[model samples]
Target chain A: EAGVAQSPRYKIIEKRQSVAFWCNPISGHATLYWYQQILGQGPKLLIQFQNNGVVDDSQLPKDRFSAERLKGVDSTLKIQPAKLEDSAVYLCASSPAQSLHFGNGTRLTVT
Target chain B: AQSVAQPEDQVNVAEGNPLTVKCTYSVSGNPYLFWYVQYPNRGLQFLLKYITGDNLVKGSYGFEAEFNKSQTSFHLKKPSALVSDSALYFCAVRDGVNQGGKLIFGQGTELSVKP
Candidate 1:
């Protein structure tokens, strides 16, 4: 079985520039998630989608970040007016039940 | 609030020796614990999980985690560690109150198996 898939494994953008990351979860997986992993820390859940409907996004910074899962299969996370502090890896994961399978992640570098 | 904690920043063990990475959790209800491994520049790989019915859960790559309910801890363990086992280990938890199954992760522990 294929694992979760993400695009543009690495990204570089200037501060205040907008950027987007894409994720295509494992086949038949009903739950999708986006997480931000800063250096020296664990992955923090940014948002969660259960079949194209958002389940949780309390930790997400609404002022700058947004995500959507259209059709429940693929999702996109966007950061507008990116900040230097936003330089981190954006990881996408999918879960059928308890255990989650993750993609390689998009490492964003904001200069 | 649900949270997971990895008390140690790094754990070092020699090859062929036993290894342990400590983790503790806080939750208001029954806890669903998990362990994941991440190599450099890579995403996390599911190692094991403790939902119920098992205190000791064996997982991929000869790794295992023992969930101690009383202690509120789930520590990852490996017998006869290999150098290839070196990686960052994360402990995560989900609580019954959270219907979404969104995980709260620990800060992560770096494991180094020296050959």
Candidate 2:
């Protein structure tokens, strides 16, 4: 079976610019997640969605980051006015059960 | 709040030797523990999880982890290490009672198996 899919394997943007990342989860998966992994650090959960509704997004920076899963199949995460501290890899994952399957991730470099 | 900690920044072991990556956690009640592996520039892949079952849980790629509730620890282990096994490992935990539970991840442990 195919795993979670993400678009734009890599991205580069200047500080204060805006960037967006897309994710397409596994077929029939009920839960989707977005995480941010800074270099040399473990991934931090940014947001989670169960179907079309958000489950948790308490850790997300509401002032600069936002995400949505409209159809419960695909999702998008956006960062406006990006900061240098935002340079990290954005990962998308899905879970049919309790175990999560991840994508290759989008590496964002903010200069 | 639930949180996880990977005490080691990196671990180096000779191929064919036993390997272990240490992890500890803090949670209010019973914890749902997990281990994940990530290759360079890639996302995390589920390795194993301890969810109200046996203390020792085996998972993909010949990996296993022991969950010690008394100590609040879940350390990843393997009998024989391989060069290919070198990668970053993370430990995570969630509050069992929280329906919409969110995983709290450790900083990560980098494993290097030297051939």
Candidate 3:
């Protein structure tokens, strides 16, 4: 089976700009997750989705970070007014009830 | 809350020597432990996991981990290290107490194999 897919493998934008990353989870996986990985650190869960509905987003910065998993399949994470600190890798993962499979991720650089 | 810890920031070893990357975790309920390897510019690749039963689980590429419940540790081990094995290793956990399929990951341990 194919792994999770992510678009725009790399992106560079100025601060205060808006950027969006897209993810396509594995077929039939009910759970999808978005994670932010700053350099020299672990990946942090920004949001989680069960089907088309959100299950968790407590760590998400609601003011600027937003994510949607529409139609219970694909997801999109957007960061409006991207901050300098927002420069990191945006990872997408999906699970079939156990361990998650991850994508190559989009490396976002906010200048 | 559930969390994971990789005590060592990095581990250095020779190509033919044994290697171990330490990991410990905290969870409220039944603990599910996993190991993942990440190469530069690539996504994490699953290594092995401990769901239940065997304390020792074998995984891809001659990698294995021992789940020590008493010590609350799950450490990755390989008998003979390869230069190609150099990468970042992460420890992750999912707990029944946490709910859902959420996973908490460790900061990661960088492994370097010298020839």
Q: How large a fraction of the reference contact set does each model reproduce?
A: 0.85, 0.83, 0.71
Worst 10 residues of 2 chain B by lDDT: B95-104
Comparing 2 with 3 on lDDT, the higher-scoring candidate is: 3
Considering summed lDDT, which 10 consecutive residues are worst modelled in model 3 chain A?
A91-100
Worst 10 residues of 3 chain B by lDDT: B94-103
lDDT of 3 by residue, B23-93 (tens): 99999888999999999999999999988898999999999999998999999999999999999999999
Clash number for every model? 0, 0, 0
lDDT of 3 at A14: 99
Q: Residue by residue across B1-115, what tens digits does model 1's lDDT show?
A: 8999999999999999999999999999999999999999999999999988879999999999999999999999988899999999999999966646799899999999999
For candidate 2, the per-residue lDDT at B84 reads 100
- Expressed as tens digits, the lDDT of each residue in A1-111 for candidate 2 is 998999899999999999999999999998999999999888899999999999999989999999999998999999998999999999998987667889999999999
Candidate achieving higher lDDT, 1 or 2:
1
Q: Deviation in angstroms for B60 in model 3?
A: 0.9
Q: In candidate 3, which residue pairs get closer than 3 Å at backbone N, Cα or C atoms, i.e. clash?
A: none
Off by over 4 Å in 2: none
Candidate 2 colliding pairs: none
Total backbone collisions, model 3: 0
